[model samples]
Target: MKISLQINASPYQHQAADSAWHFIQAAILSGHDICRVFFYHDGVFNALRDSRPPGDERDVVKRWSELHAKHGVDLVVCVSSAQRRGLLEQTVAKKLGGYQSALADGFRIAGLGLLMEALIDADRHITFGD
Candidate 1:
């Protein structure tokens, strides 16, 4: 099965991103495919590379990066949300006149069109709460 997980909250203030991470990992382990993970609203913060959790805690952003590195799953952030938070992809960073965010390589700053596309193709479309 293919899944698209849409996140809507800042990762630190809520467990939505964390829960999505576990679900993604489990699906990968079980031979299911996660089509992509889309970050919207404050959820775009999940792709911020500078997030540092306490030594004893989990870093949700890092985990999302790991998923991108290991599984080739697309990590996407809504372009509007990203811009509001000062996040950008390579091309977008240049367009915005800022340094390319780490999200440049690990994730893509996309429009809602991509989200609609994901929904059309995915077996299940799940939205994680804000």
Candidate 2:
């Protein structure tokens, strides 16, 4: 199945983001396909490359990168939402002179139009947050 997981909450404030990762891993292990992951609202923080967690806390950003590399997952962040939260990819951040690079290596900066296309083309759309 082609699964599109939408995350709409910040990574630190909720467990949905973590759960979504686990679910994706398991689904992939079980021979399922993850179509794409849409990070909206505060969930765009998950793609931030400079997110530093305490030693005891889990590294959600690293996990996301791993998922992307391992599964060829298309991690799409909403353009408007990312601009509001200041999530920039490395190239964009360098060109635009931002202090931080929010998008990880495998993630891409996209618009809601892509999300709409995914919704239309994806086999299953699962939202992980409110």
List, residue by residue over 1-130, the lDDT tens digit for candidate 2: 8888899988889988988998998889988889899999988888888778998988998888888887789999887898787777666778889555677777788899888988988899999977
- Each prediction's TM-score versus the true structure: 0.89, 0.90
> What do the candidate models score in CA lDDT, each in turn?
0.84, 0.86
Once fitted onto the true fold, the runs of candidate 1 whose alpha carbons sit more than 4 angstroms away are 94-98, 102-105
- Cα RMSD, model 1: 1.7
Residue 1 Cα positional deviation in candidate 1, in Å, after optimal superposition: 0.9
Candidate 2 TM-score over all chains jointly: 0.90
Candidate 1 local lDDT, 79-108, one digit each (tens): 998888887767777876857564734777
Clashing pairs in 1: none
